[model samples]
Target: MSEYIKVAVDAMGGDYAPQEPVKGVVEALREKPELYVYLVGQEDVLKKELDKYTYPEERLEVVHASEIIETGEPPVHAIQKKKDSSLVKALRMVRSKEASAFVSCGSTGAVLVGGQVLVGKSKGVERAPLAPLIPTATGVSLLIDCGANVDARSSHLVQFARMGSIYMEYVMGVKNPKVGLVNIGAEEEKGNALVKETYPLLKECKDINFIGNVEARDIPKGVCDVVVCEAFVGNVILKLYEGVGATLISKVKAGMMSTLRSKIGALLVKPALKETLKSFDASEYGGAPLLGLKGLVVKAHGSSKANEIKNSLIQCITFSKEDICGKIQENMKQDNKGDN
Candidate 1:
C-alpha cells in the first residue's frame, strides 16, 4: 500500500472536462494532504487548465492520453478501440494497481464497461452494482444497482443488498444498516417475480439487517438504510429523485421572489434554505461507486462541476482506507462457503 491514497482521474471526461475536472483535482489535493492524483488527459489541455490553480505540485502528476471517447459511441467498442482515451487509461491504472481508485465524470456506459472489463470483479461477485448515497429526510440512504445490471436476476439483487450493506456500514459509518427490497408495497409477496424471489433470500440471509420492502414513496422518509433493486427500477428512482429535488428547489426560489412580502420572508430564510438545499444536492454526496469491483471505480455526473469532482475524489480516500474491496471480497467468500 502506498502512503498516499493514489487516484487516477479522467481529466477530459465530463462536460466541463479539463476545466472542472482539473480544478476539482486541485481542490482535492489541497484538502487531502494524503492524496496523490494522476490527471489523465491530453497533456497540453490539462496543463493549460492546471495553470489556473496553485495546488500541491508534488502530489499531482499529469499523464497524457491521445484519444477521447464521445458519449454517443458504443461503450464496449469505444473502450476496445480507444486504447489511449482518458477513461480507458485511468481504468488501466486501477487494474495495474498504479492507483488505488479511478474517478471519472465521463460517459457512464464507457465507465461501466471499462470497469467490468478492465478492473474486473472480485471473486464470487456475480455483478457490480452502482450504489449512490441519496439524501432522505432523516439523513441519506444507499441506492444500489442504480445504473448497472438492468436485467438482473433475483440472485443479483441479493448480492446488491449485501454489497450495499457493507458500503453503508464501512464507508458511510452506518452500523448494522437496514436493508430494504424496493417494491410497490410493504407486503412480502407484492412485487414482480424478481423482488418476491429476492425478498425471501435477503430475509434468510444472516449477515445483513434485512428490513423488508421499501416503497418508492417511502424512500425519501429514510425508511431503510440500503434500498436494493435491479438497475431499471433503481435508475428510475434516482432520476426521479434528482428531478423532483431540483424542481422543488426551483419552485421555492420562484415563489419566494414572486411577491414583495415573500421576498422579505425569503431574505430572512435564505441562509437556512441554502443549507437545507445543499444537503439534498446529489453532488454534495459524491459520485456513485461501482461496488464489488476488484478496484474502486466512481462515476460522477456527466455535467459535474469542480465541487462535485472534489467531493468524489475525497470519497475515494475513505473508500481506499477502509479496504472496501477486500471487505466485500471476504464477505463474498463467506457467502460461497455457506452455500457449499
Candidate 2:
C-alpha cells in the first residue's frame, strides 16, 4: 500500500543464512532500485554482513535481534519463547504494517503455523497452502497445498484448484489455465471419498477451466497447467520430482564418463545437454511462495545460496508490483459469491 515495496528477509532462517541469504538480498537491491528491505537477525552478525556491501541508506534497513530459531525447533515453542528471534520479529513487522512482505528459508512448518496465527488469513478461507511452482514444458505450473495441509478434504481440494488457477493466470501469465486433480486413475469414480467428492465439484465449476484427474506420471508430461492435491501427496511428489531429476542427470553424466568414445560424445553434446537440463534445475525458478496469507511469504530452499535468495527477493518484487494478494482476494470473492 505504501509508495515503495518493502520486504523482511529472515537473515537466519535457511541452512546458509546470515551470509548466503544476506548476500542474495544485496544482489536483489542492485537490480531493483525501487524495492526496499529490512534484514532481520542478530544485530552484530547482520551488520557485519551488511558492512560487506554498500546500498542506499534510506532504501535498506537492518532490524537487530538477539535470538536465532533453528529449523529443527518446534514451531509453536520456537515462536513463543524466541519472541526476539529474527523470524518472529520479521513477521511482527508485517502484522504491525511495518513491512509489506516476509521471506524465510527457516522452517516450512514454522512458517505455515506462524503465518496463519500471526499474519492471519483472508476472510472465508479455512486453510492456506504452501504453493510453489514446478517448471512444465509449456512454462510453469503452480502446485498447491504442497506441504501445508497434508491431510486435506474434498472442499479443500476445491479451494486449491480455484486458488491455483487464479495464481497461474494472474502471476504466471497463463490464461484460462487448466486445473487437474491428482488421482490414481482417470475414471470419475476411482478415488478415495475426498477425491470422489472433489471430482464432481471440479467438473461443475464454471470459474476455472477444470480438467479431470492427472496421474502422477502425467505431471512432467505437462498435462495440466495447475496440479491439485493434498499436501501429503503433493509433498511426496515434489520430493520425488527433485530426487529423480538429480539422480537421472547424475547417472547420465556417470555413464558418459565410463568410456573414451562416450567421453568424446559427451563433450560434443555437453552444451546442448546443459541448456536442456537447466529447466529442471529448481534453483533457477526461485523459492516457493506460501499463498492465501494476507501478505506475501516465500520459502527459499533450505540450502539456498546467494543467487537463489536473490531470485526469491526478485519474486517478491514482482508479486507486490502485480498486486497478487489483492488479485487473489478479488478472485476468491467471486468464487464465494458463486457458491452462495
Candidate 3:
C-alpha cells in the first residue's frame, strides 16, 4: 500500500466546472496512486463525471457541497455566506486536518479570502502572499505576491522573500535560492516607494539570499530564483508573461503551417519543438500557493484543465512530504525572536 496524501479539490470551481475538475482529479489519482482525492461539490454532477474514469474506488471520494461561489461575487461575502460552497468546504477540510492541502481553480478573490479566513495563517506570519513558479531560461523562478496583497507593505515583501526562500530550498530543492526585488532598473535607488523601501530590508535581512534589484526583463532569464514584489507589479508580470507566452506559441504554430515548405519543416521539428514549448507551459508548474498559511492552499487558473489540476494535486504531495508549513513557521519564529 502506498502512503496516503489526502487532497481536497473544488470540483465545482473553475470555468469548466465539474467536468474539468473531476477529470483532473481522476487523472491525478491515476498518475499518483498514493493520492486520495476528496472531490467536494454537488455529488450528483461529480458522480456523473467520475463514473467515466477507471480507478480504485477507495482512492477517490466525493464530498457533497451544495453551494457554488460565482466568479463575480465579493470574495469576503462569498466566503462568509457560502459555508457549504465547494470552495469553502474544501478549505474547511484543510483547516480541520481532514486533508493535507486544498486545490481550487475558482475565483481568485474567493481562493485568497478563503485561504486566509478558512485555513488561517501560521504563527508569526502577518500576511500571506500568493507565490507561483514561472518558467525561466535557466529553470523556474518563484514570483511572490503574484495576485495576492496588492497594497502589501515593506514588511510583507520581506516575509515573502523569506518564505519564498524556504519554499525554494526545501520543496523545490533549490539551494539558497537568490531573492530579487522586482524593479524597473538594476540600480539600488530605482523603483517606486515600495520597491525602494523593500530593497534595503531584503538586503539587510539574513534570512534570504538577497541578490538586489532584478529588472522585469531579467526575470525570464532566471536572474533570481525568487522574485519579490507587491501584487500590482507581480500581477502585471504574471499577466504579461502569460500573454506573451500564449501569443508566441500561437504565432509559432501559425507560421509552421503558413506554406508547404514550412509545413514540411514543421513536421520534421514538431516533436522537438513541442517538447521545448511544453516546458514553458504555465500549467505544468501547478498552481499559485498562498504561502504562510496553516494548511497548504493552492489556487489554479480559473480556466484550469486536467493537466494543471493534476500538476497542482501532485505538487501537494511534495509539499506535505517536505513539511513546508512547519519550516515556514520555524523560520518565522526565529526571525521574530531575533527582532525581540
Candidate 4:
C-alpha cells in the first residue's frame, strides 16, 4: 500500500475561490497518488468544481463547511462567528490530528489568528510568523515574518533566525545558509532601534551563521540566504522586492515592443530571459508557511491560481513526508540550549 499524507485544504479561501484552489488540490492528487486530501468548504460548490477534473475517486474527500472568512474582518471575530467556515474547519482537523497539515489561501489575519488560537504554537515559540520563500542567485532564501506580527521584538527576530536556519538546512537543502538581519545599512550603527539592537544580539548568537546586516539593495542580488527581521521590515522588503522586479519586467517588455528593431531583438533574447526570470515568478513557489505554530498553516498568495495552489498542496506532502514539524521541535530544543 502506498503511504498517504492527509492534508486538509480550505477550498473557499483566496480571491480565486472554489475553482482555482479546487483545481490545485486535484492537480496534486494527479501528481502524487499517495496524497489524500480532505477539502473543507461548501459541499455543493466543491463538488461542482471537482466534477470538472478527472482524479482518482478514493483519493479525494470533502469535509463540508458553510461559511467563508473575508479579508477585512478581525481574525478572532471571524473565527468565532464563522465556526462552520472552511478555515476554522481545517484548523480543527489539525487540532484533532486528523490531518498531517493544513493549507489555506485565505485572509492573512485569519490564518495567523487560527494558527495561534486553534492549532497552537510550539513549546518556546514566541509568535507564529509567516515565512515566504524567495529565489536568489544562490538559490531560494527564507524571508521570515512576511505577514503576521508587525510589532516584533529583538528576541523574536533571533528566534526567526534560529527557526529559519533549521528550515533552510533541512527542507531547502542549503548548506550553512548565511543569516542576515535586514537593515538600512551594512554598518552596525545604521538602522532604527530594532535593527540596531538586533545587530549585536544576532552577532553574539553562535547558533546561526549571523553574517551581519543586509540592505534592501542586496536582496535581489541574493547576498544572504536567510533574511531575518520583524514583520514591519520583512513585509516592506518582500513587497518592495516584488514591486521592483515586476516594474523592471514590465519596462523591459514595453521597451522591446516600442520599435521594429527592438521587436526583432526580443525574439533572440526571449528564451534566455524567460529562463532567467522563471525563478522570480512568486506564484510558482506556492504559499508561505506560518512557522512556530503547533500545526503547519500555509498562507498562499491572495492572487494564487490553480498551479500555485497545486504547488502549495504538493508542499504539504513534503512538509509531512520530511517530518518538518519534528525537525523544528528538535531545532527549538538546540536553540534553547545555547547560542551554538
Task: Order the candidates by lDDT, highest first.
Answer: 1, 3, 4, 2
* lDDT by residue for model 3 (1-340), tens: 4479999999998998888888888888888878999999999988988888887888888999999999999999999999999999999999999998999999999999999999999999989899999999888999998765679889889999999998899889999899999989999999999889988877778777899999888999999999998998889999999999999889989999999999999999999988998888788898989999998999999989988999999889989888999999998887734331
TM-score of 3: 0.94
Scored by lDDT, model 3 comes in at: 0.91
Candidate 4 Cα errors over 4 Å, as ranges: 334-336
**How would you encode candidate 1's per-residue C-alpha lDDT over 249-292 as one tens digit per residue?**
88989999999999999999999988988888888888999999
Candidate 4: residue 101 lDDT (0-100): 84
- State each model's C-alpha RMSD to the native: 1.5, 1.8, 1.9, 1.9
Report lDDT per candidate: 0.92, 0.83, 0.91, 0.86
TM-score of each: 0.96, 0.95, 0.94, 0.94
What are the runs in model 1 whose C-alpha is more than 4 Å off?
336-340
Clashing pairs in 3: none
Residue range 59-165, candidate 2, lDDT tens digits: 78889878888888898888888889888889888777688788888888787777888887776566788888887675677888786667788877887888788
Rank by TM-score (best first) = 1, 2, 3, 4
Looking at model 4, residue 314 earns an lDDT score of 81
- lDDT of candidate 3 at residue 149, scale 0 to 100: 67
**What is the C-alpha local distance difference test score of candidate 2?**
0.83
